[model samples]
Target: MGLSLRTSRFRGAVYFGSKNLLPRNLETMKTRKFLGISLSLIIINLAAIMERADENLLPAVYKEVSEAFSAGPSDLGYLTFVRNFVQGLASPVAGILAINYDRPTVLAIGTLCWALSTAAVGASKYFLQVAFWRAVNGFGLAIVIPALQSFIADSYKDGVRGAGFGFLNLVGTVGGIGGGAIATVMAGNDFWGVPGWRCAFIMMATLSCLIGFLVFQFVVDPRRISTDHDTGKISNREKLIDKSNTSSVTVWSESLAAMKSVMKVQTFQFIVLQGLVGSIPWTAIVFFTFWFELIGFDHNGAATLVSLFAAGCALGSFLGGVIADRLSQIYPHSGRIMCAQFSSFMGIPFSLFLLRVIPQNVSSYYIFAVTLFIMGLTISWCATATNGPMFAEVVPANHRTMIYAFDRAFEVSFSSFAAPVVGILSEKIYGYDPKSVDPLLGSTREAFALSRGLLAMMVVPFGLCSLFYTPLYWTFKQDRENARTASIKETEML
Candidate 1:
């Protein structure tokens, strides 16, 4: 017999089976739907993983790129900044798109943007060409964060969402490490008719495009709702429905109103503020490989060290998710905020260790590697597991994407300036203008200067995040309950 379709508006139920679903039949159908959801998770994440690797790929390979483009450290820094600036600028656009259209469509577009632009960068002979392509690449990278994050937030409730997000971060961060290794190994070798680095970009771009196609064809969006005001419970595994009333609202006014309302939340504002500071350290990661090359290590060695940092980042992020998830189970009210505060406070020492500790020679590489790893771990807990859920819990699924979008935009727009600033600091420490580093290039002095500048910038964010996170403990509970109530009412209105 064919499966039947049943839906109820008032009761809020949808069934795609016969009037009576036999226990065995229901079990099999449930199994099949679960499999579909699993496949969707796999494909979307695979596309995301490749996108992350592509983002990491350029920075990892930037050493050779610098040589090829005849660019100085600051010029290379500007390239990184340019891409992120574009990403920041495009974040709102991506959020708006996500809100207006379906997630998969937006994701597909972003995937193609990076793949094509990265390919263009691979083929470019001019610095401007490379810069232009990198900017496009940043636009692609922008949606990967907010879209996927919104999906996670939309799909799961607060109690279980951390683990889902943590896993997402784990895989993505590992992809970052893998991207570095791939770029490093391929930077100098020849491939099927292309230079090694070029081959790296082309191959990744090709694979991502294929994943993009799969996203358009197969990825199923989970349920997005204004929320049920009465029940305060929504199932992650529930089949999605477009609540008709909400769907009929004028998109522009409603979306703007939703955006304005979330921005007014004090906790949301604090989280966005913390994001500006937290994102600065990532600039170090982007520049870390370049610094390694300048310090006398070859390309492969530097990549390996950076990978170590990535691994630490992945491990820490995974642990954060696990810890926070556990906390949610044990302490429903303040677990997430508490974990976030702890992570923020813990970052201070790690930042100091990685930046303040001097590397005298190549033998001292492991010291920096270990410190960087610990630093990576310390840095991830807040963003990966805590932040997404924290913002998401207070917003309805309808506006969840923008919450993340604005947060990203807030942070990226400010953090975009970090590269030039860090470069300037490095210049002062090295005691040379951009053009005159031949003798001191890659010297211990340059490394120290770079590290000191990086360290100097990290102090404020790490210290201040704890301060910002503290207010959440006092405010998050009430805010969350209020949102929960409001989302339901909003859904009914829609």
Candidate 2:
């Protein structure tokens, strides 16, 4: 009897031990999946935040440079010209690198470049030096963004891609907020009597480099790490063979052909045109923060308002993705079209109200803040929501990165030119006062007012864009139906 009891006890102990170990194994798996998702999100957010930090840093830096060197309105245009021209020029190269190299290495190099460029900006003495460094900064960002976005799209499945992108946008929004908040806080205090604005750049550069190091060390390339069957590993030789067989052309030739193909697609052409039109307001608002301060608010106040704009953009991005995803399940193309149309249509009236109707005396600051938040939400949603998905779907998976890069190149080039033109307009139309002793010393307030007023005029382009979307949607619908029919016919033949 004693032997029987001892044996039974041992058996019970083994059973319980195995049962407990099962949960531990499951928990470990869960933790790993969570970490993987979290890491990807962080990478996406970091890329966006790094680019947007330039926007947040602009106001403070502009203030410092203006005070130090007495930067005029035209000088500000030169700064924009440098930053945007570099970004536009580097986009195609970045796209090529993203497709050819390992994404992690490319991103690491980009992060390092960005960090060094930002640091150089802080250390520079002359205006031309600042412009040159800013161009380098833009070049770094040009590499980072396309690669990061392509990685995310490659990692996610279509069913949940929108939600994943929405989450990524949320993370990016948080990063932007964090960047602005940090700048605001630093600008509020003098660290060891170091200038607050200068400290902002130093801190940003340090953080960027540290994050890059972490990414280089720990962030596994999703192409290598993802276990999804769709993302099968292929040797470089296989990739090259596949490319050769698909187009019988060199990479650049293939890229150019793809561009021609996309342009021939009416939907794609319209979308690109609409994107350019919509982008003007976005670039204007981001760069005009310095003018905001010149108009009325203190540095901190302007920063806070910009932070709110970022928040609104985040919300819009999330909603836009969700709505588009759901609508695609039902109406196919209608949701995205409506989202763009409504946002642009509504933006016009709101902008006009802010510019023309609002009385200037009673805390116009809050009014502008509220208007900007709405404008940001609508504009960002319209900008990113449909275009990303359209680009992803219209182009073949292999060519998506190149097509996106090409689209970016066109949009950025035009906007780069447009930014300087806007600045010039401000100087000519609003800033110059013939009666004033210092005609060259443009009135910042009038400049901002003119900028806002000019932005409101974009309503015309927005309406034109909305009209263009109709034909684009019809063309996309036809193409989709044709593809579906062809797929069905092929399966039937099989």
Candidate 3:
């Protein structure tokens, strides 16, 4: 059982039990490393960063976008609404593709879609054109995200899956911060006779295309490489498929079966239910930078505040996963659920403090910074600490992509409404006058109104999200046991 010196250099192939089958050219380079992490993981993580950067590009420059399009809060909200609605509705494409193709190929296709769309959004001459491109952007994300999630699920074992997802999120958040910061700083200036925001999008698209290429060429599919530990041989189930031999009808039927299997899990159902409510607050927070700008903070200041909060969330994601991993070891059945509820409950108090208690003025910048940072650190744990790892536990390995896809489909489709709702409440109920907004000075009254709209969407949802996790404590144990039993039968049959 001991690995020899030759095995160490090709650790990836050895770990997956495919060392002898590796291509002759790649024998000495079976696994590559960067800063102690696997090259495959690094590539995928970089892809995640680019995806997030592309997503945050528009939101960071909402003020400039509004000015360029002669739009209001409602129009801005509608842009986010359209993107998320399409992303949610189209998420199943990822699951379907995963059934018939390698995830790296699926990911490459998605990256191309989004890259093209991002460039189109930058070049668009009309608001409608931008909207169309944004929809395309959403479709791209719908394809990429689920594939990425399932890839990580297969790469990490059950015990460390939370940390895997958290590490991904943490790295992805860096791209988001960079995208938002660059867009915000550049919105006031132009590059080569083009608007700075447009330039930002174009640059991101170029970078994305390169990353997509790297992913397609370098990242191996973990599921395809797995072997039977007891026999020290290939598992019949993990053989690489002959793509030409598979039919469309067969793929569809298999996909449908996976969907049904995932849908039957009570744990998945509860998690999706919580996600529907929990996602609303995040959807509404797209207006955070815009609100800060309206409160008279300049571009740099607004970006700084948002970045601080994002940095906290980034670190907190990793911390939460580590904590939940340790807790799950101790309390197996209920520890993750407890962590999730506590995280969700923290959202309510923080939403109040950030949107209501903090004075809506530039002078209170430090107060808002500290509060937002701490709030983000505490409230960002639910997904990494519980939902993702729990989803993996309660479903068969093959159904992982389907479960995550459906979760996004349900949660985002419903939560997509929050953006427009916030805009409506701000304009209709709180009396925000978009035309009266001074581009340079900013309107305190408008900031206050936007803050009110945010509160309406955030507080009640946080409480409900917390309450929804209660059922998972009861359902998770049974579902997890069933999954394990099924997996054992599957292995025996293979």
lDDT winner among the candidates?
3
Distance from true location, Cα of 203 in model 2, Å: 1.2
Per-residue lDDT tens digits for candidate 1, residues 381-480, read: 8875678888887776667878888888889878877776777778766553434334224566666676666776677777887777777777777878
RMSD of every candidate to native, in Å, equals: 6.4, 6.3, 6.3
Best by TM-score: 3
For each candidate, the alpha-carbon lDDT, in order, equals 0.75, 0.65, 0.88
* Displacement of the residue 304 alpha carbon in candidate 2, Å: 1.7
Q: Tens digits of per-residue lDDT for model 2 on 317-435?
A: 87877777777777776666776777666667766675567654325778877977887677666644576666666654544556566667776766666556655676676663213
lDDT of 3 by residue, 409-476 (tens): 99988999999899999999999999889999889999999999999999999999999999987899
Ranking by lDDT: 3, 1, 2
TM-score of each: 0.87, 0.81, 0.92
Q: What is the lDDT of residue 145 in candidate 2?
A: 71
Off by over 4 Å in 3: 1-37, 229-240
Query: Model 2: how far is 220 from its true place, Å?
Result: 3.6
Which 10-residue window of candidate 2 scores lowest in summed lDDT?
A: 432-441
Number of colliding residue pairs in each model:
3, 0, 0
lDDT of 1: 0.75
Segments of candidate 1 deviating more than 4 angstroms: 1-21, 192-194, 224-249, 432-441, 490-494
